[model samples]
Structure formats: structure tokens, C-alpha cells
Target chain A: MEIITSNQNSRVKLWTSLQTAKGRQQSGSYLLDGWHLVQEALNQAAPIQAVIATEAQMDEHLADVPQGVPAFQVTDEVARHIAKTNNPQGIFAQTSLPNNSFDSKYVHAGQWLLLDRIQDPGNVGTLVRTADAAGFTGVALSVGSADPFGPKVVRAMQGSQFHLKVIKDVDLATWIDDLEENNYDVYGTTLSDTSVDYKTVVPEKSFALILGNEGQGLDPELLAKTSANLHINFLGKAESLNVAVAGGILMFALN
Target chain B: MEIITSNQNSRVKLWTSLQTAKGRQQSGSYLLDGWHLVQEALNQAAPIQAVIATEAQMDEHLADVPQGVPAFQVTDEVARHIAKTNNPQGIFAQTSLPNNSFDSKYVHAGQWLLLDRIQDPGNVGTLVRTADAAGFTGVALSVGSADPFGPKVVRAMQGSQFHLKVIKDVDLATWIDDLEENNYDVYGTTLSDTSVDYKTVVPEKSFALILGNEGQGLDPELLAKTSANLHINFLGKAESLNVAVAGGILMFALN
Candidate 1:
């Protein structure tokens, strides 16, 4: 085990960079903090590049760490500096970014959720987790969406990213064309007259569900490309459902 | 219009106090920020105790504020102090806290959502908003749940609180008993043997759905008293669904 005492250590600098989207993109890795996330990474056999823990956390959860993984011990102060939350859990793992590219054949035959620039990290993460729970084959994130590897998204996903295929930085417009060419039915969410009630349609075995940005519903250009747009009918005064919650209802009900 | 420049102004001090739960309870009011929320308050004809805004905001949204309401113009610095978010919208209103007490008769006849100590303000607020979308009659908050009037919760609810009845500090256990005595079907969410698939159950016209806390789900004693307990079955590795997402699925499906 290596001991890191200084926040200025080169390794610490690399770990700190994982906190931001640009840094994660440049480094090709992200940080996972807390016991649950670290444990999930180990169980899923994710490519954990390194593990860092405070002495106390190392003492408590050392055995749970995968054998042969590089481990580092840091002081409480260093751990706090590396953590983003007010109350740091003291255990963290740096895992290589998973390949976010998938073949069109896989998209053709699997259940996919395509996100269009969903901005909130929590919302993005929750949708990923919900997609996982609904047994989605994969998630395709459009370019403008929040980084799936951001700290808040990682926390909210609870390691579901390791369990499911997550493809990012895709041109959803082109993806819709490719999906259509493969004979896959694409459903976009919207509230227009052309849209059918989500409950009335029966989902095929393999299909794509498109969710839009938080403030705006699906773009009209995207909506025009779908087999049929759908809406969740409700009676109350809320202008719209929280994106994640709406995604969950659609995923669970349609799946 | 009254102009107040000092952060130490007695009115400013009182408004700042509304940031905390104790302060809100003690003062019998809470703060609502942003044009959307303030406008909703006015539209609902809620009791607006005071309205405060930066000079610019007051000019832009002046026509929306009730004509007879007391208004204060504060400098940007004072507006920032009273605002909870970094990007303060510079418009705020102090509104009377709604009476949380409801006649037992209303509980007996209407569709209800009982939240059991759900701690996350976002989750609490989202659930309230979801309940509104599903056209639930009201929401009852158990003792341990985050304060519904908290700023973060208010922001997430997106003015839904003004559109529906949100009864706080409710004892869910006794509320369940009262609901049962009135022949209401109290369905609790759980994953045990006694619980059936949520998809299989037909919701009655007037029923209660009990959602539990984030980390730990519904308390066992409360679950025991439910007419039936239900679970949403899925194939993913996630141990559970997000509380708000779960509540949304249940509310939308069952209703």
C-alpha cells in the first residue's frame, strides 16, 4: 500500500481533476466515493485504476477491496480535500471510463433509452438507475446532456453504470435514423395532439424511448422522426413531471 | 412600495430567519423565490404576507404582484442574503404557512399520499409534485420527513404546494389506522413475500399510497397495518428505485 500525505501529490492532483466534467473527459477516468459505490464497482469487476481511503476507512473496509488493485492510504485532511461532499465518506476509487460506443446492431435488437440533453446530474443519474431497473439494454446520451461520470450523477446512479451499457456523445438525430433503418420502433415523449397515451400502446420486444431536456420537452425535429410520440395523462396543475420521474414511469410501464 | 437598503433591517432579519425550519415554524411563514413561484402564489390567491424584490425585479414583475399587497424594494446585496441559491432570482415573497391540519372526513374520502420520514428535500418536493400530477387529494408528511416548506423542497415542488393540500407533521401510523377504519385500501410499498406485484393490483377510487424513507423503506409496523403491500418488479442490478421515481410510477399507474 502506498501512503499519500500531501494534497499536492501528483496522484492527488489527478484524482482531484476527476471532480469536473472537463477533467474527467481529459483524464479518461472518474472518481467514485462512499462504500456502496466502491463495493458495487468491485462486484461488477469494473476497471478500477486506483483506490484511496483514509486510514480509518482502510482499516474498516480493506478486506472488501479487490485483491491486487493498487491501494493508497491518505490522511483525513487529504481525503477531505479529494471529496466533494460536506461529509466525506473517506473511501474513493478511480475507475477508467467505460467505452461509450456501441454498435448499431446492438441498438437494433435491444431496449434503449436515448436522453436529449438532460442537464441535472441527479436527474441524469436517476434516469440511468431507472433504466437499469427497467432492464433497459443500454442508454444513449446526446452531446449536451450532463456528464454521466460527474460526481453527483455517479452518486445518484449507485453503480448502475457498471451494470448497463452507457453510450455518450451521440448525435440522437442520426441515431434515430439508424434505429429506424434497423426496423426498431422509436417513441419520443411529447404532449402534442399526434401523441398517443403512453398506457394505450404496447411496446415491442426491442424499442427506443427518447426523453428530452428538463425545461423543454422533446425537440420537434426529433419528435417528427419517431414512430409515435406519447404522453402520460394527468389531471393536476403541474406543468410537467420531473424528467427522471417521467422517464421511470415510461420505462417501467412500457417495458 | 417600501425601500429597505440595510441587510440588518428588522424585516430583512425576519426574512432571513425563514431560511430555517424552526424560524419558519416560529414565524408562521416561509419564503418563496423566483417569478414563477411568486406568480403562482398570487394566482392561487394565497396569503402573501410580504413581497420583496430588487428594484429591477419589482419593475419587471410589478404588474403580477397583488395591488393591495405590501411590497419592499431591497438592494441586490440584501436580496442575495435572503435568497438560498447562488443565482438568486431577486424576487421573493413571504407567504403564510398553510394549515396542515385536515378534517378526518377529507382523509376518509379522498386519494391520499403518506410520506414516511423521507429525508431528501428534492425527493419530498418531487413526490408532492408527482402527487399533484396524479390528482391525489392531498399529501401527509410524517414527523421525520424534510420540511415541505424548506427552500429546496419548495423549488423542486415548482409551486405544486399552492395547487394542493400538503399536511405536514402527520403521524402516518395513526393516519393509516383512520384510513383503514374508513374502508380505505392502504397500499404500502415493500419487497417482501406479503407484497404482490404493483401491476396486478387494481386501485380503488379512494385509496392511500404509503411511500417510505430513502435509505430504509417503510417501517415494519406501518407495513403490517397496510391493506396490501406492493413491489415493482424489475431485472436490473439496482437494489431499489429512487423514492420519487417509485412514487411516480405507483401514483400514475394506480390512479
Candidate 2:
């Protein structure tokens, strides 16, 4: 274990890079902040590149870092700068992005959450966690969806990312084609009168439930090709729901 | 239309006071940040006492300020000091403290969201917005719940606050007592076996649906008195949901 105290340190730059979408994509790393998330990442046997802690924070919390793991104690100012949070909890970890390639051969013949362009980090994370809890097969993060590995999304998932097969950067059309080949049913969420109640849409052997963004609903192109559209009836004045929450309820219902 | 350049000004101290629970309670005012929220507040005819803007932000966005509303321009540093967010849209408003009193005489019977100690600001805001969209009569904020007017909550609500009756600081027992007096059926969310499937619960004419905290869940004392204890049946491996998301699903179902 070595202590790096300077702002110019290469490791500090690496951790800071994970804060941006571009930086994260380039480095193939995402920043996991605070003690709890870092610990959870460690428990899941997630890929760990390095850990950064402030001297005071290290003394208070990270005194028991395992022998082989690389740990660094940096100046408080440098730690704050790298973590991007006023209170960093004195621990930040750089975790390598998992190979998100899905094994089509192992695709579960059950309910799945297909997210399309859900931009809110919290919403995406909540939906992923709910999908996992509702027993949906791994989440398929389609193009334009917020990065699940991003800091805000990670917190919203509450560590469920480790327990689920979170696939990212997929072509929805191609994914749908693959599912059709594998005999999977597809259901898209919509607010149309013709749509069936989400409750009535019984889960089949293999199925994919598509949820669109909050404001736009499902992409029209994607909606046209789905097996059928499902709607959650609203007796209240609200015309619709937050996409992630809607997705969660549908997954719970269908699952 | 007074420009507040001094951070020590009484109005500035009052605006900044909203950052803490004690300050919010002592003075019946809270802060609203960002353009969307401030705009929504304006549209809702919410009491807007003062507006703080930087010269740059004002020139770009402040054309719509009503004729009578008091507006002020501050340096970027001072604006940043008063703003809750680092990358503020450069607009901040002082909204009068929302009346926390529920008009019992106005109780006519409809769906109501009784939040039990949901302490997270984001969760509180999301629940408020969801409840409003679901067409609930009002949202009853319980004792341990986060301040509904907090900046994070205001941001999350997306202007849903103005659409519903937001009563805070009431005695939960007495509030429930009043609801029961008005013949409202009470239901509380719980993880216990005694809880029934939320989907199965019918939306009666007048009912109170209670939600619990993020971690420990509904208080046993409150759960014991409810007419029914309900739970979202899970077919997956995950346990429970984010409070706000769960509240959304239950509210949608019950509504």
C-alpha cells in the first residue's frame, strides 16, 4: 500500500475520469464512492483497480484493508477533488467495467426489462434494481439509456447491479431479432386505449417487457414491432408514471 | 425589486436558512432552485417572495418575471453561495412556507397517501409527485419524513407540490384518527406475512394508504391499527423497492 498525496497523481486522474460519461467510456472504469458502495463492490468480487482514501478517513474506516489490495491515502483536498462529493466518506474505488456481453444461449425464457433511452440515472438504477427484485431476467440497457455504472445510478440500484446480468450498449432491433429467434415474447408499455391491462398480460416461457423514457413513452419504431402493448390503468389524474416505476410494476405483475 | 448584494442581509439569511430543518421550521419559508421548478412554482401561483439571479442568468432567462414580483441580481459568487446546486440555472425563489394544516371540514373522501417517516428528500419529492399524478386527495407527511419543501424535494417533485394538499407537522395518530373519523379505510404497506397483495386491494370511495420508511419499514404501532396491511408480491430475488417507486406502484394500484 502506498500513499499518493498530490493532485497531479495519475491514479487521481483515473478516478476523476469516471465522473464523466466520456471519461468513463475511455478509461473503462467507473467511480464507486463512499464506504458502503466500495465495500459492496468488493463483496461481489467486482473488478477492483485501486482504492483511494484520505489519511483521516483511512485511519477511521479503512485501517483493515486486505493485505494484497492496492490502497492509497491522499490529501483530503485531493480526495475531495477526485471523488466529486463534499463528503467522500474517505473511500473511493476504481472498478473495471464488466464485459457486458450477453450469452444469447443462456437467455432466460422469462420476463425481461428492456429499457429505451431512460436518461435519468436514478430512474434507470431503480428500474434495474426493481427488475432484479421482480425476478426479471437481466436488464438490457439499450442505446441512449443512462450508464448503470455511473455514480448516481449505482446508488439508486443499491448494489443490485452485482446480482443481475446488466447488459449495456445493445441494438434494440437486433436484440429483438435475437429474442424472436429464441422464441421469446415481447410486451411494450403504452398508454393507448387498445393496450391490454398490464395485469392481464400473462408471463410466458420467454418474454421481454419494453419501457420507454418518462416523457416520450416507448419509441414508436420499437413499439410497432412488439408482440403487444400493455397499459397500467390510472384512475388518478396523472396520465402516466415515472418509467422506472412503471417498469417495476409491470415486471412485478408479469413476473 | 431590491437587489441583495450583501450575503448578511436578512432576506439572504432567511433564504439560506431553508437548508436546515430547524431553519425551515422556525421560519415558514423554503428555497426553490433551477429554472423548471421556479417556473412551475410561478405557474402554480405559489407565493414567491423574492427572486435571486446573477446578471448573466438574469439577462438570459429572467424576461418572464411578473411585473409586481421582487427580483434581485447578485454577483456569480454570491448567487453560487445562495444556490443549492453548483451549476445552478441562476434562478432562486423564496416560497412561503406551505400550510401544514389539513382542513378536516373539507374532508369529502378520496384516495390519500399517508407517508410514514419516509426520510429521504428525493423519495419524499417523488412520492409527492406520484401521489398528485395518481389523483390522491392529499399527501400527509409523517413525523420522520423529509421536508417536502427542501430543494432536493422541490426538484424531484417537478411542480407536483402545487397540485395537491401538502400537510406537514401533524400528529400521525391524530391525523389517522381524523381520517378514520371521516370513514376512510386505512391500509399500511409492510413486509409481514399478514400483509395482503397490494394488487388485490380495491380502491374504495375513501381510503388512506400508508407507506413506511426506506429501511426499517412501517412502525409496528401504526401497522397494528391499519384496516389492512398490504405488500407488493415479489416473484424475483430482490427484496422490497425504493420507497418513492414503491409508493408510486401502490398509489397507482390503489388509485
Candidate 3:
């Protein structure tokens, strides 16, 4: 094992740059922070480029790292620089973005949650996690949504990223069209004249649920393309529900 | 309006102090960081201590300020100092915490969400917001939960704080016993030999759903006192659901 004390180490510099989207694109990898995420990625056999830890973390978790994976030890200062949290668990991993060649035409069955222009990273991650817990097969994100692989999202996911399919950067309109073509009940969350209360819709084994941007409902084109718009009935004076919470309720209800 | 240019203005210092729990407790007030919240506070007739805004903000929203309220114009630097967000909406208000003399002994007859030791501020806020959207009458926080008035929670709440009763620092165990005494259905989130599937329970007009801590589930004492414990059935590989998301699903399902 090699001990890296200086922040100027080339690997350290590369790990720090992975914190940004541009750097991630250039390097073709993203950093996994903390012990659980790193351990999770390894367990799932994600493409691990390197594993870095403080001496104490390595001492406790080294035996868990599989053979033939590159591992390094970094000083506390370097570990802090690489982590997004205030107090990181002093272990990390670098993994390539999962090759997601997910086009909706290929998604013929199982439940799906779709997001459009959902800019908040935390919301995106929570929605994805909810889809997982609700037993959905996959979640698809529109091109305009926040990076599903971003740090805030990765943290919010809490290892659900490894649990199910997270398809990204697809055209939502096209996906809606494909799901409709496949006879899936594509549900859009909006309360228009033609919309039905969510409870009126029977749960389906294979369907797609679309949640819109925080301030805006689904794009008009996507809304028009959905099989039917659905509304979550609010008995109180609250104007609307939080996007993540609303999606969670819908996922569990519909699936 | 009185213009405050210097950061050292006594009023500015006092407003900045509202950012902390100690300062809020000492001054008996909390800061509302954006236009939506400030306007909501005014709309709901929450106790207003003072209103502060930038020149630009005052110019746009001046008339909306309630008559006789003490309003001041602060410099851009001062506005940022008083806000928790990186790019605030350039307006703020100081309001006294609502007087909540809630003892479950004096209660009964509407939906309630009880949170026991949920420490993440965002989770606490999201759960409260979900409770409002789910048509719950009140949300009572245990002594060990995050402060309901903390900055992060206030931001996550998105004006839902003005929509419902948010009672903080109550004895959760005692509250549970009282609700049970008052013929309320108290549902705890834990799987036990006697816990029922959440879906099997018909939505009730009057019930209290108790959500436990994020990491350690409910306090054993509180969990033991529920009218019944409920479990959410998952069909997928997810080990667990995010506490707020799970709470959202349960609230809509059980209510």
C-alpha cells in the first residue's frame, strides 16, 4: 500500500476535479464518498478505478476490498478535500458512470418514473430512491434535469443508485410516446379539466409516472402526450405537495 | 423606510442573530429568508417582529407589507447576512415563534403526524410539509428532534409552516398515551409480530401516525404505546426507504 501525504499528488488532483460535472466528463469517472457508498459500489461490482482511504479507514475496511482493485491511503487533509460532506468517513472510490444505453423503445415492461426539468439534485435523488423502494423497475430523467450522478444526488440516493436502473438524458416526450405505444398507463401529474383523481386510476403492473419541475408542471408537449393527467387530492389548504413527496405517494399508490 | 447601510446597524446584527437557535430563543423570534415565506407569514397573520428588504425588493413589494409593521431597507450585504440561501430573493421577515401550548390532553379529532427524534433538519421539515399536504391537523416534534424553526428546516418547509400547526419540543411518549386515551388511532412505523400491513388499514378521519428516528427507528417506549404498529411492504431490493419518503407514502396510505 502506498501512503499519499501531499495534496499535490496527481491522483489527488484528479479526485478533486471529479467533484465537478466538467471534470467528471473529462475524466470519465465520478467519486463515491464515505465508507458505505464505496463499499456498496464494490459489492455491486461497479467499475472501480481506485479506492482511497485514511489509514484508520483502511485498517478497518481493507479486508473487504477485493483483490486486484487499486487502493491508496491519503492524509486527512487530502481526504477532506475529496469529500463533499463536513465530516466524511475518510474512505472513497472512483467509478466510471454506468453505461446507460436506455432508450424507451427498449423499455417494454415494468413500472417507470420519469422526471422533466427537475433541477433540484436532492429531489431527483429522493424521487429515484422512492421509485426503488416502491419496487419500480427503473427511473428516467429528461435532458434538462440535474445530473443524476452529481454528488448531492449521489449522497441523497444512499446507495439506491446500485439498486435499480437510473436512465438519464433521454428525451421525455419520446419516452412518453414509446410507453404509450407499449400500452402502458402514462400518468402525468396535473389538474386540468380532463385529469382524473389518482385514486380513480387502478394500479397497473406496467406503467409510467411523470413528475414535473418544481415550479412548473410537465412541459405542455409531454403533458399532451401522457395517457391521462392525474391529480393527488389535497384535503387541506396546502397549495401543493413537495415534488419528491408527491412522487413518493404516487409511486406507492400506482404501483 | 429606514435604510440600513452598515452591517453593524443594531437591527442588522439582531436580524443576523436570528439565524441561530440560541439567538432565536434569546430574542423570541425567527427569520423568514425569502419573499414567499415573508408574504405567507403576513397572509397568515403570524406574529411579525420586523420586515427587512433590499431597496429593489422594497420597491417591488412595499405595498404588500402590512400597514404599521416596522419595515427597513438593508444593503445587499446585509440582506445576504440575514439569509440562509446562497442567492436569497432579497426580502426577509422576523416573526415570533407561534405560541403552541399543546398538551395532547387538550386535543382530539383531526389527523396528526408525530415525529420522534428525527434529527435531519431537512427530514423534519419535509415530514412537516408532507403532513400539511396529507391533510394532517398538526405535527408535534419530540424534544430530541431537530428544531422546527431552524434555517434549513424553514427553507425545506416552503411556507407549509404557515399552513398548519407545528408544535415543537413536546413529550412524545406522553402525547401517545393521551391520543390513545382520546380514542385516536396511533400508528407507529415498525414491523412486529402484531404490526399490520399499512395497506390493510382503511384510511381514518382521525388518527396519529408516529414516524421514528432516521437511523434508530422509534424509541422503544414510544413504539410500545401505539394503538398499533404498521409496516410498509416493499417488493424490490431496497434495504429501506428514506424516512421522509416513507412517511409520505404512509400518511397518504393510512389517512
Candidate 4:
């Protein structure tokens, strides 16, 4: 049993870096905070680097930690320093990033969600969670979208990443072309002259839905590549729906 | 035009207090930050107590500010102090809360959203915005839910409060009975043995949807009083959906 009290520990500094994309790129591991995420990752058999907790949390959850996994007890101050939330849960795990990258070479035949430059972390995370709930096979994030493994987005995802494949940094136009090659019907959500009502599209097993940014709707190039552009009419005066909510309603409607 | 440079000025202090529930309770007004929100309130003819902006912002948007309304030109430091966001938009309005209260004697005939103690400000605001977009007549916030006029929620709402009725501190139980008296179907969203699938509900002109808290679903007592408790089935293994996303899907489906 190892107990660390200083916030300046080398291991603590390394763990803090997992919150950023550059840090994650350097280490190939990201932090998972709170008991539920840690439990979910353990259950899903994702590669685990380490388990950490405050003394109180360790005493309660130690038995559940798998055999041979490195475990440490840290002071509450150190726990607070490493955790993102104001009130730290005191239990966390560091896990290897899953290798679920997709490209133009091969496109799987299933319900896929492609996010296009959706910058808000909350929207990105909620869309991923909603995709999982709506029975999507995977979610693909484009280059300018929020970091898929970023802390805020991961917290918003609420363990759904472990349940579904989340491929980061996807080039959506090429991916759309690959899906066409695989006989997949690709749909873009934008209100354009060529777009049809979202409900008009019948659900097929192998179709992908592309959601655009909060401010900018789908890029014209991406919309041109899609099989059909779908629009969910806002029945009331709101200028537009939040991208995640729009994605949720569309995913469920099309699925 | 009054110019305020010090953060400790009485007017700045008063404006800052609007971020809290108690302050709003006493003052009967809340702050609206950013150009879009202020412009929306002005366009909607919402009663404005005052407008404040930095000198640069004042120059850009002064013509849009309604006549006879008090305006202040504040320093950038004061604007940052009074505004909630890190990068203050510099333009703001202090407006009187709308008078749209309802009781057993009278209930409106249209779709309504009753939030049952949903705590997250982001969730509450997103739900309200979604309800507005889904053509809801109004939204009612229960006593324990996040403050309807709180800064974070209002920012999340993105001026949707001006488009529809938003009543705060509502007693949901009594309100449900009142809605029933008005020939409205009140639906409670909870996943339980007796709850029916949300899709089973037929859309009608008048109905109220009650969404529960994030972790705890609907209160059992509240569930018993609902015309029919509705549930949205999650097809995948994510366990559940975000309350706002679930509400958005159900609202559009049943609208």
C-alpha cells in the first residue's frame, strides 16, 4: 500500500497532464474520475494504467480493484489537486486510449454519428451519450470539434464511451465517401433547399448521421457528399435547436 | 450617460447580486448579459430597468437601446466584475421578471413543461430551450430545481425565456391537478414497472410533461398522480440518457 501526501509528486503531476489533448497525445492515457467511470472501465476490460484514491475512498473500494493493478492512496489535498470537479470524488483511474480510429480505407456498416466542428464540450459529450442510447454503432469526431477524450467531454459522456466506439479526429468527407462505397446511406442534418423532413427517412441498419456545429450548420461540401440532407423543423420561434438535442431527436427518429 | 469605473460601486454591486436567487427575489429583476439577449429583450418589449455596457460596446449597439431606459457606460474592469462569463460581452440589460403565474383557478391550453427538481443549471436551461423549440406553451420550474433566472441557466437558455412563459418556484403537485382540471394530460417521465413507453402517448393540443432529477427519477408520490407515467426505452447499453436529451426527444415525439 502506497500513500502519497504531496501535490508536487511526479505521479500526481503526470496524472494532471491527462486533462489536456497534448498531454494525452504524449502519454496515450487519459484520466477517469469518480467511481462509476472507474467501475465501467474495469468492467469493459479497457486497459488500465493505475487506480488512485483518497484514504477514505480506498478503504471502501479497495477490494473491487483488480488484482495486480497498481493502487495508491493520496491525501485529500492531493486528490483535490488532481481532480477537475470542485468537489472531488476521491476515486479515479488512468486508462489507455482505445484504438478505434476509422478512415477512408474501411467503413463499417452500421448507424454512425459524425460530429463536424462542434466546439462545445457539453454538446460533444451529450451527442456521444445520446448516440449510445439511440443505438448507434460508433461516433466520429472531426478535426475542429472538441477533444473526444477531454475531461469536460468525458464527464458529460457519463460512461457511454465504454459502451460504444468513439473514434477521434475523423475526416468526415472521406468517411462519408467510404460509407457510400460500403452501400451505406449517409444523412446530413441541415435545413437546405435540397433537405427533406427528418421523419421522412426510413431507418435502415447501415446509415450514418452527420451533425454540424452549433453556429454553422453542415458544411456545403459535406452536405453535397451526403445521400440526403435531413431537417428537423423548429415548430416554434427558437432560431435553432441545440446541436446535441437536434442530434438526439434525429438519431432516435431515424433509428 | 453615467460612467462607472470602480467594481465597488453600488450599482455594480447591485447588478452582480442579480446572479443569485435571493437577490432576484428581492429585486424582482435579473441581469441579461450579451448583445443577443439584450437585443432580444428590447425587441420583445420586455420591461427593461436599465442597460449597461462598456464605451466601445455602447457605440456599437446604442441605437438599438430603447429610449427613456437608463443607460450606463462602464469601464472594462467594471463590466468584467458585473458580468458572469470570463470574456464579458460588455452589453447587458436588467429586466423585470414576467408575470405569468398560474394556479388551480385557471390553466392554459397548450403543451407545458414542468421540471421536477432538475438540479443542473445547464440541463434546466437546455430543457427550457428545447421545450420552446418543440412548440411548448411554457415551462414551470419546481421549488428545488435550479433557479430559472440564475446566471448560468439564463446563459444556457440563450434568450428562449423571452420567447415563452417561464414561471419560477412552481408547486408541481398542485399544478398537475390544475392541469387535469383544464382537461390536460399530465405525463411523468420515469422508468418504472407501470410506466408506459413515451411513444405510446398521442399528441394533443394540451398536455404537460414532467421530467425528473438527474440521478433520482420522478418522486413516487408525483408518479402516482400523473395521468400516465411515460418512459423512453434506451435501445443500447448506455443505461440512460441525459434528462434534457430524453425530454427533447419525448417533447418532439408527443408534441
My TM-score estimates for the predictions, one after another, are: 0.97, 0.78, 0.95, 0.96
Find the 10 residues in a row with the least total lDDT in model 2 chain B. Answer: B99-108
Question: Per-residue lDDT tens digits of candidate 3, residues A155-217?
Answer: 888778888888888899889888888888898898453588887889654899999999987
Error of 1 at A46 (Å): 1.3
The candidates, ranked best first by lDDT, are 1, 4, 3, 2
Candidate 4 local lDDT, A98-122, one digit each (tens)? 8855464576566899999999999
Encode model 1's per-residue lDDT on A1-255: one tens digit a residue: 899999899999999999998889898999999989998999889999898999999999999887889999998888988995567989999999988766655465868999999999999999999999999988999999998998999989988998898888889999898888888889999865457999998976578999999888788899989988999888788878999999999999998
Tens digits of per-residue lDDT, candidate 2, A1-255, equal 588877788878878888888888898888778877787777778888877888877887665556567888888888889877777777888888778777655664766688888899989999988987787768887889998888899878877777777888887877777787788888887988688888676765689988888788889999888888898776554545667767766776677
Best by TM-score: 1
lDDT of 4 by residue, B1-255 (tens): 999999889989889999888888788899999999999899889999999999999999999887898999999888888886679989999999787566644776778999989999999999989998898889998889998889989888988998888987888889998898888889998766367988677856589999998999888788889888888877887878889899989999998
Q: What is the DockQ of each candidate?
A: 0.84, 0.45, 0.76, 0.81
Worst 10 residues of 4 chain A by lDDT: A100-109
Model 3 CA RMSD to the hidden true structure, in angstroms: 1.9
DockQ of candidate 2 is 0.45
- Weakest 10 consecutive residues of candidate 1 chain B by summed lDDT: B101-110
Model 3: per-residue Cα lDDT at residue A215: 91
User: Where is the poorest 10-residue window by lDDT in model 4 chain B?
Assistant: B99-108
- Roughly what TM-score does model 1 have, to 2 decimal places? 0.97
Clashing pairs in 4: none
Q: Over 4 Å off in model 4, which ranges?
A: A84-86, A191-194
Worst 10 residues of 3 chain A by lDDT: A191-200
Error of 4 at B110 (Å): 0.4
